[model samples]
Target: MTFDRRQIVAGLAGLPLAAGSASAQSGWQARFPELVMAVVPAENASGLTGRMEPFCAYLGRELGVKVTLRIANDYAAVIEGHRAGNIHIGFHGPSSYVRARTVTNGGVEPFVTTINSDGSTGYYSVLYTRADNPAASIQDLRGKNLCLVDPNSTSGNNVPRFAMSRMGIANPDQHFARVVYAGSHENAITAVLQGTCDGAFNWWNSEQDSNFSRMVNKGMVKPEDFKIIFKSDLIAGSPYAWLTALPADAKAAILKAFIEAPQKDKAAFERLSDGKDRGFHPVTHKDYETIVELQKFVDQMRRARS
Candidate 1:
């Protein structure tokens, strides 16, 4: 489904005034006693929840409303939460955000995105294999089992397919002996290291910041155990979005809290970025138009395969 730019612009223009005179005195807390922030866990659910606790508390303190974290099982669940209005805020990968927008019909608006330490607004999708595996490239891994993160993942699935077609492997499902979704970035990496799959697509901002690097730093895996065979061009950083129905003042307050978290809530900010980000930066739908087009292309590819 294509988005109407005029409708989106008109809706955005009236968002802040949505709460109207009722919110003028008491604000969103009166109407929304509690807000849920939904996320698809990349690692251990319990651990991720723990890591995000302080951030949720920070938001709660800033907004004068109770904020709770909801660990969604998959990307589609997160998208569905936004579509159903069960979730008030979301942290979504680029491709999944586009899917959410598509499913929600522009009900959600991206407010901010993470800025990499190098000051880039994007990250790379890398194809990896075990270090001991003789397979050195995507070609070498032909007819081998492959692991992907999620169907709606930007780096894990979308960019991987796009990059593979560029490399002359147009259909990964046909090229590989088997293709499977590991459901999370950590799962994809683990499958590769454990020999459950020959290769996997995951994200990398730099050697200093990535799922692999974070795992390595945590002593979960050694750096020598894996090798990167291929890397895709920079994909837009994921976004933290909110339902546009929120009061205008509430939106401003939420954005202000996020932009100031780097200084005011250093530990929570570091936890969110794994200590490798500069900070959060404002972004709009326009920033992800290319990603939306890419998602459309992938959707067409899927339909053709079916």
Candidate 2:
């Protein structure tokens, strides 16, 4: 058959131009699995991979979609991907979620939160000092080195900073000898343990099965090596969110799958959900109002310092 240039041009022009429309219609939408699951390099990448691959495979099988894992080097990269909508579904810390929302002009919405096995959706940021250190409260750490997890961490930095502001200990930089970003909560905890930092801030729930307690019990760190000098009130847990442009059916399916997953596959669910949190629960942007308020406070503080 002879090629028809004009006819071909017209045909091509009429083809669907909407991004991801074809895939969405086929019920096999794509997602960045690694980013969506918050698998970090420092946290035993091999173990994370081993644990998540099967989980992703299971989700894909049950959801009737293909899921691909994408790993970014740091939290900022993950946040950027989320802002750009390259990542359809993501697990983001509260501070990172706030930044993503700010950059995207509120384009994202929380669909569900990973619940603890006990069905709680909250965690706390704890301020720790060496067991031998005399600091009794956040105020006592004045003129000392303070190690923070990261700028984009919720329990690691944002909540701790907000807590300090509430306690009238505004700007640890001014009060402390210096403020150091340890890059990760584990690092911050390590810094305090090694005597490199006078104190450190980290996220954990007091619940016995919480991540922090699990780490301590697993001998990842010695609980006796540090003491909690301060702790923030429970903050909402991280979210599993999607961009607002996601189709309603897909959104509903995703939420339904997550919320109902634990009952279907208890063993697999236990591996992903933090011990006490049962599973994901449906949520909306309104649920994160406190986070938005916290971000505003942080932004105001940044401006004041500048």
| Per-candidate clash tally | 1, 8
Candidate 1 residue 116 C-alpha distance from true site, Å: 1.2
What are the RMSD figures for all models against the true structure? 6.4, 8.5
Which numbered prediction scores highest in lDDT against the true structure?
1
What TM-score should be assigned to candidate 1? 0.91
User: In candidate 2, which residue pairs get closer than 3 Å at backbone N, Cα or C atoms, i.e. clash?
Assistant: 115-277, 116-276, 116-277, 116-278, 117-275, 117-276, 117-277, 118-276
Q: Where is model 1 poorest over a 10-residue stretch in terms of lDDT?
A: 1-10
Residue 235's lDDT in candidate 1: 84
Q: Pick the candidate with the highest TM-score.
A: 1
Give lDDT tens digits, candidate 2, residues 252-306. Answer: 7777777777787666677664335667777887878899898888888889999
